[model samples]
Target: MLGKGIIKGMAETARNFLGSYVSAERLTTVQYPEQRIPQIEKARQFPFLVFDGDDPMKGLRCVACQICEKECPPKCIYIVKSKDKRVDYKGQMQLYPATFDIDLSVCMSCQICVEVCPFESIKMDTAYELSTTDRFGGLMVNKHQLAKSNEHYRHIHPTDAAASDAALAVEVAKAQAKAKADIEAKAKAAAEAKAKAAVITPVAPKPVAAT
Candidate 1:
């Protein structure tokens, strides 16, 4: 009986061994360089900011909100706010960001910054081919490195980028329209005040004329 158990175990082991080779025939193992797996639609890889191409300044969507910098766990985001010389809807100068930076080495790729950004300025990119001899030089991406035109953003993420562009266009148009309306309102108020002042009421003749 003891020898019978041993024989059955050996048979099971032999079956398993043969099964490995049998399954290998149907296996779909792709060789590196020869084959590639496509990424999923919602994949997030690296951090990047979107910029508007039509604007001569290549204006970035980021308003220097500092939300990304604050939310970043590694404190990798750095930004410098530049005083906007131009007037806004209220004829008041607005302050925007001048510089932005992100240290990729410190970034954990958690996408917190991207998620928390209200302006949709920052996002995660699909590019993961980052390899360099010098970590410091390669990892520390400045405004120049992080900046990409809206066209580029659309190219990388067509569906999402198109939506974002549409939203941004609406916002920009609204802001411009509000500015125009405010100016017109102010001008109209001034004109009304001038008209009221110009309309001098007729004064009654003095009592001496009756005498």
Candidate 2:
């Protein structure tokens, strides 16, 4: 009975060794660069900017609010507001970023930037392959390199993208409704003004006839 514990450990090891060949759950090793496992939906690496349309510069959702830059734990994000203001996707006037940069070398991927962004322009990316040879410039990702399409966002984070789209739709509907109400109110005011003018001028003709 002295060697009984060792015998049981050996048996367990043999069982696992056999299970690795037979059981799908036990087969964990994958061929790197050839066969890759499906990426987890919630897994995230660095952050990327989300753009709406085909043109990354024109369609970028970032209004350069600087909230993300201010809130970044590592201070990896940098933004410069454009000299000329531009309209955003919601047709609201806002200042776009003239330059945006993220230092990947210092970035901790804490997702704080994405969380603090008010414009929903930034999101955590699933891409992890960021190996580089050049130490000076390769790690510094600029706006052009950071910008990614909304379609790509949907592809990577479908649930988050759908929720964002829904929220945007709600905002657009509210803006349209407010505009319609303003137009109706103006028309009503004009009609009232015209009616008042007609009513007040009518007595002049009657007075002339009486004379």
Best by TM-score: 2
In model 1, the runs with Cα more than 4 Å from the true position are: 1-29, 54-57, 83-96, 201-211
Please report, as a residue range, the 10-residue window in candidate 1 with the lowest summed lDDT.
Answer: 86-95
What are the per-model numbers of colliding residue pairs? 0, 0
The pairs that clash in candidate 2 are none
For residues 34-118, write the lDDT of model 2, one tens digit per residue. 9989899988999999999889999999999999999998999899999998888777789999999999999999998887777
**What would you estimate as the lDDT of candidate 1?**
0.77
Q: What is the C-alpha lDDT of each candidate?
A: 0.77, 0.90
Off by over 4 Å in 2: 1-27, 186-211
